[model samples]
Each structure stands twice: as structure tokens, then as C-alpha cells.
Target: MTTNATPRLAPGPRGTFLLGNLLDLRRDLIGFLRQVSGEYGDIVRFTVAGFTVHLVTHPDHLRHVLQVNSRNYDKQSHEYRPLKLAFGEGLFTSDGDFWKKQRRLMQPAFHRQRILALGEHIVRDVVERVDAWQPYAQRGESLDVAAEMVALSMNVATKSLFSTGLRGDEEVTTIARNLDTVIGYCLYRTMVPFAPPPRVPTRRNREFTAAMTSLDGIIYRIIGERREHGGDTYDLLSMLLEARDEETGEGMPDKQMRDEIATLLLGGYETTSNQLSWAWYELSRNPDVEARLHEELDRVLGDRLPTVADVPRLEYTNRILEETLRLYPVPWLERRAAATDSIGGYHVKAGSLIYISPYLTHRHPDFWAEPERFDPDRFTPERSADRPRFAYFPFGGGPRLCIGNRLAQLEAQLTLATIAQRYRLRLVPDHPVEAKMQVTTSPRYGLRMTLEPRRPAA
Candidate 1:
């Protein structure tokens, strides 16, 4: 069924003469992508300042780039350079043999057993955080659900990484504020091709440098304390310190440890918080789905907090998370062709930028029935059996998949179940929630919602 004909460029929008599609892309990234993918077929070729870029939305093509011929495409693209400014050469930004070794050392810490054991900590944190919302529910005051999720997720990340939460509210607020600046700057740099380099003393660069410095001070201080008073601990930091290379039998260097910790903090909290925020947004809009979720949680969990063993039984809750991811996949994947290649009969030249958008692909009409509709039942085993493997890849696919995927899922499932057991979040009327593309897909105006207390099913 495959074609071996001479390769040609894929069809795409004829962009502006000088800047290509840069203006349209900057104007509205997700909308522009959806527009083009709807008009053109799967492999849409566009130019940005004469740089050839291919937006591959087909599942088969995505598999070819992310899995089948993964070695031919790598993270050496311009997309990841901004990330390296904050993450350094950590797992998120590293490649080749160095990446392989790092993955090996960190793999044991993320094992299923280890993650399951962390469920107690995750649930406890979620319980404390959600309980604090009682005042909001009692007074019927609207709270920014987006900001709440971010703070809660950051607390969970710190607990998991260091086995302790931030020292106090002020510290947590400071870290979260700085992270916003850092992430916002990185996103601006990534989207704006002509952005000034970090070395230049621009206001953005200066702010980014200050924010990174504050974050590094915290990270290195943790590393330094661990080294001074080393002890047995179950946290990720301890594991990283103990991890030794099989070949060289060496522990991670301080600089590398800082980089990895920063990467984990950035990756761990941001995506899950955004996903949870979106889940609340959708549940408020779809009462039936929300009702079913509550029914399942009540039937399975009764009056007790959810445990790791109960995750499988909470099928509907997990499905809600899956559905949310389908609609709002955070990270848009980018890779560069290390060598000349062919994709769907299109000749992809060496060094060409290959863009595979999960946001677009997840909603591909060919694969998803009523793709925009929020339906958790679509993920049932019977329904999902025939779907393309690469079609629903929110955590991405293949070897370079997001390392903390399982941990993120567990945290989300547990947090959602715990909070839904106590209260239901209702979106504020006419709040105008819109998906904004940044480092992640998040609400442009933070999700403001009021909470209603739910009684246990008798």
C-alpha cells in the first residue's frame, strides 16, 4: 500500500513572500495550524524565513518520525535551544549516548513500584490542598482554578523530588512567580525567530537571568545540603545522588544534578497542572460527564481516600484525564531531520524542521469521530482497539517519550479523584476560557471557578 514514487513537496498555504508564514503563526499558532491542516493534507510544507518546515499530522507519518525512523530525527532543532537555556544539558535537552546513559541512571527511580509507593504522598498532598478550598466553597467565591492547580502541582513536585514541601507560602509564591517569567521568556524566544540572543542585555534577558539565578540558588542549595548530610531517603533527589553509571560507576555531577532537577521541576508540574485545569473547564461544561465521574468515584471509593490499588477501579476518572489530554496536549513536538529522508512520498531534506503537533493530530477527523466533542467513552478498550497507536499520543511515543509520564498520570488521577470526592468545580459565567499556546496549552484568562461541596452517595 506504500508508494515508492519520486518524492515531492507536500501541499501547504502559500505564505507571505518575505517572512513566509511567520506572521500568521505568531498571530495564532494553534488556529493557523488547524486552518492549514484542514485545507492541506497530512504533510503540509511551509517556509519561515526560507527555512523549510513540515507539519506532519497523519498518524502513520508521526510514527515514521517519532518511532520508525527516530534516529534520523533528533532534538538538535532550534525548538529545543531555548529550553537548553533553562534546562542546560539535562535529560529533557540532551541526546545520543549521553541521553541514553542518563535515562538508564534515572529509569530505576521512575519504576512502577516506586511511583505506586509515592501515591500515599501524592494523595496526602492533594487532600491537604483541596481541604483548604473549603472557605471558597462556603463563601461561594470564585477562585482561579488554573493558579490553584499550578500551586498544588508545584507542592506535589517538590514533595516528590525533595520529600518536603516549600518552606512557606512566600517561598512557594516566589518560586512560582519566577518560573512563570522563565517559562514565558522561553516561549517568547521560541515563537519569535528574530528574538535577541540571551547574551544581549535586553529587559527580557535580564529578567530571565535573574529568575534563573533565583531558581538555581534553590536547586544548588538542595544539592549542597544533600551532599553534606547524606542519608537514606525515598525522594527523587536522593535517587539521583545515588545513581551510578554501570560502565563508569560515577554519581551525577553537581552541575548535571542541578540541570536534571530543574528539568524535572519544569516538566513535572507545568504539564499536569495545565491538564488538570482543562479537565475542570471541560467537566463544568459537560454535566453528564461530570456526573458519571462522580458516580464512579462514589461507587468505587465510597468515603475513603483513593489509593494506588484503586486506580484501576477508577476507570472513568482516568478516562476523563485521557479525554482532556486528547483535547489539550501541552507540548507540540519538534525535531530536525539529521539526514535526507522521505515522508509520505515527500522529500524531506537534511536539517529540515519537522513539526508533529499532537494537538492537531489528536483531533484528526479521519481518526477521531466528533473529534472536538469531549467523550471519555472513546477510550474504552473496545473502542480504542482499532485506533492508530500514534493517534492518541499525549505523552508522545518511542524512546524519547516524556520520562515522568506515569508519575504525572498517577498524580492527576489521584488528585482528580480526591478533589471530586469532596467538591465540584463550576466555571464562572461568561469567564471566556480560551486555549493559549505557550510552553504549554493553557487558559489565556486563568480558569476562574466556584466550588460546590458534594455529599457521599448514600
Candidate 2:
């Protein structure tokens, strides 16, 4: 770990002579990373398109990159450049003083009290959505759980962001579809190093542009309306408009507001939805976990709707979410070395890409016993006390940690409790459930499930 020592690259797979690990990476991102990290150890170094990349998986190493020496690692890298197409210079892709300023201005919106208030609306919304699933349950028809969660999460995110949900199901579907297009394109660009720029007008580029335009039109229209007709609103949009920089006493400009809003919508909606989709899949596969979840709901909720006050008592429900995140972390962490550094006794050059996988770290045998098991008890205080903090960072860590972590958790916890109270989601037989790596982790093939009603809807 001493920087003064002679520099040495970390051990890693010896890929192709010309392309290095590019083919392997593009073929299977998550699987490739997991294989290399498992084979070569924590600080695995490899080349992709002539770039020296390091896959750091140890908890201590992750802590160094994410927290202790976080300043040395930042998002100003090629990995984040593609995201700028959709997110612009928002918190997700922005760095340095600007990111700090935005984070400060927006931090209050996600505070404990703010999320608590939002939790009530989230639960109500989830209850209505879950009730709507009754028809499908009664018909015994398989429902695409992935799409369902995306739509539900979009509604929740829209409400939290604007204090009003999307106009209707059509608009929600349209916006969600556009978001997928733009995000999928961005991910494609990131993975394909030599892909054409946006200006090149490739078929995919055109689609990305169209999707972005649609999204921008909707977002700008809302911002304009909100600005012209300012009202007493408790959503994040209103807060951003009202937020004044402590140093300059200036409010966020429209462009900045748009970027931040886009970031939140993308971050909050897709991540929560994917996590929920996976949660249902896991629940279906593990009836024991589902039974315990139902037990907790019955004891704590008892045919009543869950509220923010009940969140604490729904301990098992929260653990399920934690376990899901551990198994399949969305938008896995990536950073570029801003300067030369030493990690896990290996030298990391400036501009070297550092990839950390919560998926892999969560499964590290040293820290997690039977790491692949879907046991929520792994997150219990007694069990987790000895684990490293970075061993389970689905939302990341450090100053750049996700601002809406609490809100996302609350949304998932309440939505799960609400739905579990009414029905159990069982994956359709012979259905293949494979994790797809996009802007966030998602099911490669949409998750289709048959819902079994547990009790009559209220």
C-alpha cells in the first residue's frame, strides 16, 4: 500500500493481444468482471481498448477509492461521459465544485422528515397499483412484473419530483419507454468504446436523440409551468426552485433544474423499479423468505395500510430489500483515478478506470458466509456488525453517495409491504430470469409472474 515503493500492476486475466478484454467485456459485463475478480483476486488489472482498467473488489480497497481517498477518484471519466447525453451535468455525472454545490442545495429534499412525508403518498399510490392487479390475479394470467414495477416506480418518482404524477397511464408509458431508449443507448455507448458520437446520426443515435427530445420537452414544459405559476408545493421541483445557494443566494437555473430533475427521475425510478422486480423474483423463488415477509406484514400491518410510522416495525421487509440490492446492485460503482494512487498494494495510474462490483463484493466468501444464499438475516445487526461498511453499498458511498438513498429504500419497503399484504408473485413456470446490465441492472427477459391473492382487497 506504500506509494513510495516500485509501481506494479495488479494481476488480471490475459485477454486477446490486440483487443485485450474488450470482447469478453462486451459479451458479458457482469459475468466477465466477476470471473476476473474471482480468478485474479481483489485488485485485478486488465486492458480494454488500450486503457488500463482495475477491478477492485476488496472492502478495504473499495473504501479507499470511495471514501477515505475519494477526492482522488471522480466521475469525470469516459464511463460517465455517455451518461451526459441524458443526465447532462447533473449530480450523477457532474464532479468537483459544481457537484458539491448541487449536492448541498438538493440535500434537504431527501432529509428524514421529507422522506417520511413522501412515504405516505408512496404507500397510497402503491396500494392503488396493487389493487389494480386484482383482475390479473383473478384471471390467473401471468403479468410482466418488470413492466409493472417500472410503471409503478415511475408514478412514485413523478409524484415525488413534481408533487403530481404523470397525466395518465399513456404518458407514463411513453416517458418510461423514452427513458429506456435514451438510457439503453447511453449504456451501449459506454460499453462500445469506438461507437460513433451522437452527431454521427446512426440509427441508435437518432433514437437516442428522439427519446431525449421527448423527455426534454416534457421536463421543460413542467419546469416552465411551475416557474410561471409558482405555488405551495412540497415536491423536489419546488424545493429546487426555491433553493438558494448559501454563498450566492441564487436559485438553480432552469437548465440546472432540468438536469437535476432528470438525474433524480432516472436514478430514483429505474433503480427502485429494478430492485423491486428482482425482489419479487427472489420472493417467488424462495417461498420461505416470502412466508417470513408475510408473517411480518401480518403482525405489524394486519390488513391495514403501512405508513411511515410502521416502517421501523417492518424489519423483515426492509431486510428483503437489502438482500436484493446485495444480490443485484443496479448501476454498479465506477470511478477514474484522478491522480496516481496505490490500492491493495498495487499501483493505479492517473486516469485508470476503477470498477467495484457490489454484486461481487456482497458475495465475497471472506465477508459473507454462503454468499449466494438469499438470506435476509445476513443484514441483521448482530450479523452485520463485523462487516465492512463498503461491503454492501448498493447506493455507493462517500460525498457522492446517492442523495435519494432513503427515499428509494422507503419506496421499496412500503411498496413491498403493500403488495405482499394482498398477493404473492410467483414466477411463471419455465420462465428464464437473467440479469440484464443497462443503466441499471434489469431482467434480460421481462419477469412474468402469476399473482396469488392472499386476502381480499380493501
Candidate 3:
């Protein structure tokens, strides 16, 4: 049934003859994308120096690219290069056989049961951290909620990975600081095409190199220490160390172990933290939704900290998180280099690039009602049942769907529910909310908010 009609060129804004939409894309990626999709229908083609970039907005089209014919789209996208430099050949960066092997070895750690079992530990970390925030609440202090979540998520992720929390760990602190430097540097280069190489002896290059060296030193130290204390343990570190290929009975090499752990550090905490930050921002902006969330938490737990068993009952809380992700997905854009394919009847020759944004696709008018508004009920089972499977993929889809998705959900839900049980966050008056797009979507100016202790459910 395939038609031989040549697909019409995707509509987009006219830019300088040679640059096409490159300037718009680099200047304001989020706003530029919204403009393109808003005006140009579902598929947008923007040519940059003779290179055609396709941004697919429809759910069915996304599924085709991410799930159905995913084999034709490898992880050789331009966006992945910076991440590959940061993470090396880890599960998040590798492809084909290597990715498959790493994914298999790590799958058991993130099993539903295991993720559920870790709920108590996650709450304990949240409780410990939030307890300290109480003093600021009492003093009416405005705190950077985004930074707070980053710190909290780092502790949770590290604890989950190593069975040792990062609180009071100077080495981890230094490593995290350097990771920030590297991520910011990489993001800038990705957007600004003419940026100099990292090898140049500029101040920025030196900083990036120093950060990478510091990160490497800390990671290698941890790996060496783990090797010295070898024994079977339930943490991800031990699991990775002990796992062997079923056929060859070979374990992951030390370098791979480091890569996977680094992958955990980069991907694990960053997205969940950003998601929670945006969730709080949305909650603060919508009092009615916040009230409903509180009511749900009150009815579900009645002052008890949320457990994995209670997550299903905290339906509204989950909805808020879902809605937040819809508005601001962590990894906003997914890029792939097409390997001889066609999308929406358009011939996608080899070397062509495809861009899919959960941030944009989740807000596509065809799939979402009032796409710009914050509406948690949009995620209610009845409402969501009719939507295409790819319409709401915060964790992505298909073989490359994020392996840590279940764990992230459990972590976010538990953390949000636990905090909602005890505190309500309010944004500082006139504080502007803006997204700073990088590998993850973060608040441009950190979300500044004051905490108010909520009354216990009667």
C-alpha cells in the first residue's frame, strides 16, 4: 500500500539561504521548536548547509522511529557525541551487542520487585534531607528547590548504586561539581556549532579537562576500592561486578564497570531531580491542583510516609508527576541518524538526521488537549486509554526505552508523596520560571521557593 508519490518537503521558516533554521535552533531551542511545530504541521524539515534535519511530532511517527523500525536509527546522533564523551561506552552510550549485554546484566537490578523493595530506603533518604529543610521553613527562608532536589537525588542514586549514601562525601561532591562543568560545556558546544575544540588551551578547555580528570580520579578510586573488597552484594556496583555473559561466562571489564557507573551518575540523578523540581514549580503555580494532591496524600496515607504498596493509591500524585514530565521532559530531544529509511512517506537517505522531542511531542495538539496548560487529570486512565502508546513516553519506548524508568517512577512518586505529606512549597513572588535546556531541562534561574509545613490529616 505504499505510494510512490514523493513526499512534500516539510514546511519551516525561511532563514538565511545557507543557514536555514540553524540560527533559530541555536538561539532558543525550546522556543524555536515550538514555533516550527506550531506552524509547520507534524513534520518539520530545516536545512543547515545542505543537511536536512527532520523533527517528527506525531505519535505514530515517533513510534515508527523509536520502536517499529528502530534498527534503522542508531545512537550515532550528533546529540549523543557530548554524552558519549562524558559517559564513554556505558549502557546509555553504547549500541548493538555491547548495549544489549550491559542492559541484560543490569536488568535484574531494576526489576519491579527490586525497585519496590528499595522504596523504604528512598523515603529514608528523603526524610533525612527534608528534616534539615525544616529549619529554613521555620525561618521563612527562600531555598533553591531545584538545587535541593539535585542534592537529594544524588544521595538517593548513589545509595541505590553503591549501598552507600553521598551525604558528607567530599570526593563525590567534587565529582558532582566537575560533572556540572562538563555537562554545561558540552551543551554550549552542541548548540553553538562554531565552538572551539576541548583540546584548545582556552580557560574553558582547561576547566573542562580538569573537571574530567577529577571525575575520572574519583570514579577509578571507587572502582579500585570495590575491587579490593570483593564479595556478592545487592547494590548495582556488586551486581555489575559479579554478572557474567551467559555464553562466555565473562564479567564486565573494569573500564566498562566505570562507564556504567558513570552512566548511572549522569543519567540517574539529573533527570529525576529536574523532574521533581518542575513538579514542585507546577504545584506552586496551581493551588487547586496542589490542594487536590494534598487531599489524595491525606486520604491515602493519613500522615504515614508513602510506601511502594501505596503508590498505586496515590493516583493524583502520579498524575502531577506525569503532567510535569509532559511539559518538561528531562532529555527534551532525541536525535538519530537515519540509516536508509522513510518517515511519513518522506525518503530518509543515509546520513539524514531525525529529531524527536518528548517536550514537543507531549504538547502536540493532535494528541493533547489544551497542550500548554497544566492538567494532571489528562493522565487519568479513562482519558489516557485512547491515546497512542508513544504519546506519553517520558521514559521513551522500545528496546532503548530507559532501563531505569521503573526505578525513577518509584523514586519520584515516593519522594513527591512523602514531601507532599508534610510540606507545601510556594514560589517567591514574581520569580520568573524559565527552562535552561541542556542534556536535561532545568530551571534557568533555580526555582526559589519557601516551604510551609502542612497540617497532619485529621
Whichever of 1 and 3 has more lDDT, that candidate is 1
Q: List the residue pairs that clash in candidate 3.
A: none
lDDT for 262 (candidate 3) = 84
List TM-scores for all candidates, in order.
0.96, 0.96, 0.94
Full-model lDDT for every candidate = 0.89, 0.88, 0.82
- lDDT for each residue of candidate 1 in 303-362, tens digit (9 for 90 to 100): 999999999999999999999999999647789999999999889999889988999999
Ranking by lDDT: 1, 2, 3
Q: Model 2: residues >4 Å from true position, as ranges?
A: 1-5
Q: Mark the regions of model 3 whose C-alpha exceeds 4 Å error after superposition.
A: 1-8, 165-167, 192-197, 456-458
Model 1 clashing residue pairs (backbone)? none
Worst 10 residues of 2 by lDDT: 164-173
Ranking by TM-score: 2, 1, 3
Question: Model 2, 1-458: lDDT tens per residue?
Answer: 56485677799988888789999988878889988887899889998877789998899999999999999998877679889988988999999888999899999888899788898889888888877888898899999999889989999998899876356667777778888898889878787768988889989989988998998888898899989999887788887888899998999988889899888888879899999999999999899999999999999999999999999999999999999999888646688998999998798999899987888888888898888888999989999999989888898888878899999999999999999899999999999988877557899899999999898888
Predicted structure 1: clash tally: 0
Runs with alpha carbons beyond 4 Å of true place in candidate 1: 1-6, 456-458
Writing each residue's lDDT as its tens digit, candidate 3 over 68-98 gives 9987778776677777777889888788887
Which candidate has the highest lDDT of all? 1
